[model samples]
Target: MADMSLGPGLGSSDTCRSAARQAGAPRVLLVIPCFNEEASIGGLLNEIAAIGRGYHTLVVDDGSSDATCTVASCRSPVARLAQNLGIGGAVQTGIKYAARQDFDFCIQIDGDGQHDPRAIEKLLDAYRSHPTNITIGSRFIDHSGFCSTPMRRAGIRLIVLALNGLFTGGRITDPTSGMRLLDRSAIAFFARSYPADFPEPISLAWAMRAGLTVSEVPVEMRARKAGVSSIDGIKSASYMIRVLGYILLARLVRAP
Candidate 1:
């Protein structure tokens, strides 16, 4: 695990506004957490850069035994972990870095190329329009994107139902979506503590329990461009059962 020492604070509003003026906008960090995604990460980074958003990109290489680090480093700064931590750990690492660097917002994008970079604008627009701590890019809202398999969609629906019942703050249609944008407050909260098991749904529940507001917007997602998913076949069934149990447990526990 990376040592997470808090960096200098955000300082006064005047200073923050000055810095934003210098940078042309508030700093947004694109955190890509990957494991053995060398085949598609480079292209994904290129696509993000081509959008001319001027967002900083950080690739968290989750102890991949392959050349994922090298390939990612060619396009963006790579934070190579010493060992394989699950998706949750990798994402927490990126969030910690974002906190330490005093980024105004952090957006999590899967390295498998399943998330579309073009949808980033939609997420940003939602953030600007609403007072939300987290904005999730959902594929099920519009049903226009490349939704996951039938089995996975069914599992996600079950999880969403559970979350809606347990968390009355807001309705979540895509609890399993990895594509999400977190503001500074949300980033700091997640950096301090995050769910290690079933992070997607569990973290959403935990955030709501912590009194954070959540919202979702329609975004188009693509199928994976390369490499196989970590969960597939029989593993998908196990994933659903385990994630549902975790979400329930998360609801029972008080958020720290």
Candidate 2:
């Protein structure tokens, strides 16, 4: 209702990363959106550390009524929001912080434990190969790991069809995938303006419309170990329609 905002065995990462980034690698920041993810978060933090030494992590607790806030406080600097602003708001907050931190690139990972921290290599590798600003970790490209449920898969396919058929000049295999990496320019763009609802696909179309380089890399993901999906069967159809309307309608009326 109000406006927004990790681990012990982890000492402050600054002491560890200050040396790592001295090798000339761009500073990387991980933005994790959490809502009642207490069951899966603690273990995920451990995995994140294993990704690399220089990577910094920030957990935005979206007004959860559970122990999510307390659990993440020990590991990372948590932005506990005053009220629930949804996942989009949480990510915007993180990106804004990333911009202030002077991060060279930022990656958005899910707290539900659905995204694999290890696949970050492929995302980074893709970034290195192009002048791209956004690299999304796509599940369908390799058809690896869990690709979500049948109903949601159908919805995602429909959205992709629409993107290729009408909007988003170039094709993006998994617009709805939350596992994405953003370079400096993208961090600036997102820090200034981001979609308020269902940001994945809408933001992808918006970025493409704005003429930013966007690419996708194949990745493996796992089924959620805890917490429920934001979209359920009852709302999937309507959710799909709302997102489509937002993307198509918003673009049509923008004053060039």
Candidate 3:
């Protein structure tokens, strides 16, 4: 999508010539943020590699207390966070890396395997077709039979409704969905000021506030292959309130 070769050739410089020659690859980085997701990280990395896009996958361990780092290290090009930073921190670290490396784009997928590597093409397609927009994967857009528990679905709906209100005209079906693709401009914005917690919705609001193009494409999501959700039960309710509050705060802070 969008000239898969969106940035400089893999090795316009001699340093990366070998990497470039090994694969006539595009300069894309798949940033998977992990929190104790050892069981699924291996499978996710292998699947992403199979996409055959010369796109490198980097796992930010997020201070996972389990075998996450070991599993990730077994794979090349993975970055580990020495301490457990929350999701936002881990993702911000990835964005900074992507920006510094001059990557054309960065795709954020879950380390839990709920996000499908196959959808990488769709994200790339969306980004290519709408070069200026940030493409978010929306599970509810056409709901190709993927199942979400009723309670979880309800919470997602509530968040989307609130997000639309705050943003005035934006319609987002999955405000908390972790799967997203960001072009260079979007990446630069996130690298500098990503929200510390409950970032997806807040980031969307921030993007719209800055008059950036933001869009969503429908993608099927799989159930988590392993590990409990980082936000659920009491934590889910707490996070919902926290995320909603952040959305309001973002709107207020941006208002004239």
Candidate 4:
């Protein structure tokens, strides 16, 4: 049997101790942006809680017109949004909350199951050690166990390659991977001006423009357990175009 007693402050004893172990390591917030993701949210939250690290999860329920809010609310400390804010806004909401609450770092994760909770430790390890540069979970680094459609994989590779050339002047390997860890500097940066739509790509460029160091760490990706992707096929093409245009626009603006 699982520990039904687990919720927010109750199980965070382990996380608090773990946080103490690192001495200077930032307090971590695992931010999940959800839209009608009740099926996977509960399991995902429990899995992350099982990590035994002092990690708190915030589910920015983006106006999920389903059991998502109800189910999430039953759990402890899961935040919710009153209106559909889309992915970008949902994530930004969580980020802002994390910043305001004075968390040391925030890990942006998809509410869908495409991101593996187990890989979180690897990203955290990198972030803890580096203490600089944003750590992104890249699914294309080794490609040993990740599963995705061929077309989507190809599209991601192309986008990653282009992103490397255009922004980082280096290869990203997984440009669209939603799993990422941001330090306090990054957390503050984005809390002020996160992209409103399709933020993963645009935010990368924005981080770079702010002279924040960025790096990718290898992580195996998973297929979503339920719910259709917000972006696919033709949507990917449109997203690429829109982000590319936004990148150019962003470059024109002087850094704050």
Candidate 5:
């Protein structure tokens, strides 16, 4: 089982109430999945604390062989996985925790610091105004942020074409965006089963197939603050091909 523990000054009834008053928002949990991100985790936690939005933060350490858990524990609660389960497993762990804890919403944020914490408000607002099962933070809609390399952009375009063609849901511009918001229903569905590989694109396809509504809000993303990306260099090409394959396969299978 994954070990769950709260960080100092977090996950308390008093804390939750205080945050609710500050934001006047429902129970929201920020699920951060990290692997060997010790260099950047501390900064990310500090940034969230600075926001002071009352959204509870959970760092799902995906069996990092570093001090990531140690650093994250100093700020927010952590559900440390016993072993590396890739991004999919790590996110599913967080989703399950959110379901059991009865959170109103769960937001997935990467630990490498590419996703901006300030844009979180944009996501929350989108959900509040036009609620959907999933709200994706996209850098392509406005095209104002660091939109990544040309090759990766091309790859994302291909994946988007495939998703729009295969799925009946609305058009998805950035299927590879890591930042997303999930309602209770989406959380429950993903908690039960989330893709373990090429999760971003594949899970989006699965969620759509499962009859969940998805929408996107424009958010600016910066380059990674620290640590090398898992999908870099030649790996980008391989990632694109594999993710495309998974998206097609997901279309063929029954929705989870």
Candidate 6:
């Protein structure tokens, strides 16, 4: 079994020293964006640990009012935000920490156990082969995994249409996929200033517009094992509008 017993007080300081830093492997940090996902995170951590890929893990606990921090800290390094910084902020916190630690690559994963840790190798492999600044693990590239609902699928299609129109670089199939691989450039950029509330689609579109190489790899993602989605029901419509506006503005912005 993976050692799931990290000590308490990891979040006692501004910086936490909780990773093992195993040698002879690429310096990759798995940045998990967590809210009140106390129930699902432990299994995800264990799955990642079982991969034996020698990845350092950091759980960005976004001011959860539950046992999220406690449970996650026991398995990996925990960055406890004073308040909920939303998905973008929480993800950026982990990326910033990884950048400061000099990790060569950073991979973002959901804390709700939606993404399978086994496919992490596929993402890393695609990065190695293509060498893009960012590699999004796409569900629609192969039309596999949770394809989502009709309305949501149509929304994603519109967003992707905007992305392709905005950037000369090809197209992105799954614009809202949270599972992504970020190289040093992408990591450093996100560490400085990431998107706000709804980040995935906006960031991906913006990165392509900014002349950063972006690509996609095929990966299967599951439904969240626990907790409610932050973007569901009424929130999704608002998310669509916000991300669309961001993409339009990004396209008009200067490249580089």
Better of 1 and 3 by lDDT: 1
For 1-256, candidate 6 gives per-residue lDDT tens digits of 1112223433323233333234335678899988899999999999999988767788888888999988887788888888877888888887877788777889999999989999888999998787899888899978877776676787888898888877865568888999999999998888877877568987886677767888888888887788887667767777787788888877777423
lDDT (0 to 1) per candidate: 0.86, 0.82, 0.78, 0.75, 0.88, 0.81
| Tens-digit per-residue lDDT, 77-99, candidate 1 | 87787888889999999898889
TM-score of 3: 0.87
The worst-scoring run of ten residues by lDDT in candidate 4 lies at: 1-10
Q: Give lDDT tens digits, candidate 5, residues 1-256.
A: 4554545544457565566658856888899999999999999999998998877899999999999999998888887778888899899888987887778899999999999999998999999899999999999999997999998999999999999999976678989999999998999999889988888999989999988989999999999988887777789999999988888888887855
The C-alpha stretches of model 5 lying farther than 4 A from their native spots are 1-24
- Number of the candidate with higher TM-score, 1 or 3: 1
What are the root-mean-square deviations of the candidates from the true structure over C-alphas? 3.7, 3.1, 5.9, 5.6, 2.6, 5.3
Off by over 4 Å in 6: 1-24, 254-256
lDDT per residue, candidate 4, 35-79, as tens digits? 999998888877777777757788777877888766766663666
Residue pair clashes in candidate 4: 15-53, 15-54
- lDDT (0-100) at residue 240 of candidate 5? 93
TM-score of 6: 0.89
Summed over model 3, clashes come to: 1
- Each model's TM-score, in the order given? 0.92, 0.90, 0.87, 0.86, 0.92, 0.89
- Superposition TM-score, candidate 5 onto the true structure: 0.92
Q: Predict model 5's lDDT versus the native.
A: 0.88
Candidate 3 residue 250 Cα shift, in angstroms, is: 0.6
**TM-score of model 4 vs. true structure:** 0.86
Q: Number of clashes in model 6?
A: 0
* Candidate rank order under lDDT: 5, 1, 2, 6, 3, 4
